[model samples]
Target: MLDMFRYNWQVRQDWFEWCRELPQERTGGMGSILATLFHVANGEQIWINSMQGTPVIVKEGVTSLEEAVEFTELTQSITEQFLQSWDDELAMKTLIKKRRDGSEITFTYDKIIKHLIAHEIHHIGQLSIWSREIGRKPVSSDLIFRDY
Candidate 1:
């Protein structure tokens, strides 16, 4: 489970790093490439916190992919430590979460992990389209596909 999370993080980090060489306009929608990265990283933190029934921890004004990566790493570290206390049975327990609009739903921790990875993949697809608009190759999503 943790390995899946790490693979998703590596893909996102690789995309952000690859995007750094391009002009800001290429990734400007939804702010810039850095902001989009932060959005994805922050959402990961939000969902992880929600799953744990903890208050969301937020840091504002992350202006670079480097900073966003650091924040994401920190969030992942904390979340992993939290998860360490749980066994397989506990990890599968359903979590009750509230939507911003006040609706409520339940999801298991594994389900949330699936959602987080899928959400990142969806946004990365947007980044890939943007990259192609400017005639750039999208970063490879497979971590083991490259030496890294």
Candidate 2:
């Protein structure tokens, strides 16, 4: 799980750096680079909170590139803290989470961690598409690119 978190942090940093090189119009427009980043970060937080049987605190919304980058950094820190505090029993235990639409689901801690990483990758793909469409260089976000 720590490895997965590190991989996500690196990919998010790459995306933030790439966004910095884009024109303001491309980076700050509706559904822009920052919006995607914030969405990804918020999704991870929401998932983590749900898996922990805590009330979801991060709200979904659009944000500026700078704000998204900052939020991503904070999210990474919180996730790392949670990972460090997690016990082996908690990692292997199952969690029952209630969905927004009044549905309930069960997932193990390991499964939640996997879903979080997969969700980030999915958003990164969308961000890459947007970056290409806006004439910016999209960073490679593949896990294999990360050392260790």
TM-score of each: 0.80, 0.81
Best by lDDT: 2
Model 2 spans > 4 angstroms off? 25-30, 53-55, 60-62, 86-88
Residue 30, model 2, lDDT: 32
lDDT of 1 by residue, 48-90 (tens): 7877777898677486667777887888786677667756776
Quality of model 1 by C-alpha lDDT: 0.75
Whole-model lDDT values for every prediction: 0.75, 0.77
